[model samples]
Target chain A: TQLLEQSPQFLSIQEGENLTVYCNSSSVFSSLQWYRQEPGEGPVLLVTVVTGGEVKKLKRLTFQFGDARKDSSLHITAAQPGDTGLYLCAGVSLGNQGGKLIFGQGTELSVKP
Target chain B: IAGITQAPTSQILAAGRRMTLRCTQDMRHNAMYWYRQDLGLGLRLIHYSNTAGTTGKGEVPDGYSVSRANTDDFPLTLASAVPSQTSVYFCASKASAGYSYNEQFFGPGTRLTVL
Candidate 1:
C-alpha cells in the first residue's frame, strides 16, 4: 500500500495570505491529483499532475508535481474564504488496477476574512 | 446534472445491524467506487467495480461488500455494523474515456452513525 503524508494538518490564515500544502510519499506514482472538499460535500478535483516537475495553474492556484514523482505541492496565492476547505492529495499508479487512488491524510485550511 | 445520487443522505443504525448504502450515477460510467472518510484518515477506498458484473476489493474492504448489477448502480453493504464503521461514505464514478487521467465525479456523500 502506498502512503501519502500531508503536512500542516491544520492551517489558519487571514484572507490574502499565501499558503502552500505539501504531499510526500516514498512510493512512486504515475499521477497525482489534488482535491478540495467543503463541509458536508464530497471532494472536488482541483488538479492532476501526471509528469514529474509538471506545474499547472488554475486562477490563483498552482499545483506542482515533484521531480521524482514521489511528492506534490499545492500553492494558493492571495487566499480567500472560498479557499477554505480540506485539501487532499491522491496518488495513482499504472496497471489494470491503476484507477484506484491512494489518498493522503488531508490538510484542513481555514481562511478568515 | 444529477451526476450521482446516494440514498438516505444520513443514517443512524445500531451495532450488529445490517445496512446497505445505495449509489447511482446517471452518466453511465463504467467504473464506480465506494470510499469512507474518517476524521483523520482522509478517504479510504472500500470497494470498486470496473464494470457491470465485476468487482474488486479496495484498501479497507474487510467490513464492506459491494455489488454491481448494472452500469449505473453500485451499492455497499455492511453485514454487522460496528461503532468503528461510523464515518462519512462517498460514492464516485468515472467515465471510460478519461479513466486514466481525468477526475471522478463524486456524490454528495452519506453520513452514517453506528451506535
Candidate 2:
C-alpha cells in the first residue's frame, strides 16, 4: 500500500505568519493533490501537481512536487486566519483501482488573530 | 447545485446493529467514493465505484460494503457496527473525462457513532 506521511501534525501560528507543510512518500505517484478541510465538512480540493518539479500558486499558497515525484510541499505566505484548517495530501498511483487516493494524516493549522 | 447529498446527517446506533449510509450525486459524475475520517488518521477510503454496476474496495474496506445500482446513488452498508467504526463518513464524486487530475467534490459528511 502506498502511504503519504505529513510532517508537523499540528501547527499554531499568528496571522500573517508563514508556514510550510511537507508530505513525503516512498512510492512514486502519477499525481498529487492538496486539500483543505474544515470542521463538519468534507475536504475541498486546493490544487493538483502532476509533473515532477512542478509548482503551482494560488494567491498566497504555493505547492511544489518533488523532482522524484515521491514528495510534495505546501507553503502559505502571510497566512491569515481564514487559512486555518486541516490540510491533506493525497497521491494517485498508476493502475490504481478507480484512481484511488492514498492520503496523508494531515496538518491541522490554527492561526490566531 | 447540491453537488452531493448524504442521508441521515448524523446517526447513533448500538453495537452489532446494521446500518447503511446513503449517498447520491446529481452531477452525473462517473466516479463516486466512500471515505471515513478519524482523529489522527485524516481520511481513508472504504469503497469506490468508477461507474454504475461496478464497485471496488479501498484502503479500509473491512466491515463495509457498497453497491452502485445506477449513476447517482451509492450506498455503503455496515453489516455489524462496532465502536471502532465510529467516525465521520464523506461521499465524493468526480467527473472522469479529465485525466488523473480531475477534481473531486465532497458532501457535507455523515457523523456516525456506535455505542
Q: Candidate 2 docking: what grade?
A: medium
lDDT of 2 by residue, A1-113 (tens): 77899988999999999999999999999999999999888899999999999999999999999999999999999989999999999989866645678889999999999
> Against the native chain B, what TM-score does each candidate's chain B reach?
0.95, 0.96
What is the CAPRI rating of model 1's predicted complex? medium
User: lDDT of each prediction vs. the true structure?
Assistant: 0.91, 0.92
The alpha-carbon lDDT assigned to residue A43 of candidate 1 equals 92
Q: For residue A52, give model 2's deviation from the true position in Å.
A: 0.4
Which digits, one per residue and each the tens of the lDDT, describe model 1 over residues B19-96?
A: 999999999888899999998899999998888898989989998899999999999999999999999999999886
Query: Model 2: runs farther than 4 Å from truth?
Result: none
**Candidate 2 chain B, which ten residues in sequence have the lowest lDDT sum?**
B95-104
**lDDT by residue for model 1 over A1-113, one digit each (tens)?**
67999998999999999999999999888899999999999999999999999999999999999999999999999999999999999988656254788889999999999
Residue A31 Cα positional deviation in candidate 1, in Å, after optimal superposition = 0.6
lDDT of 2 by residue, B51-82 (tens): 89988888899999999999999999999999
For all candidates, what are the clash counts?
Answer: 0, 0
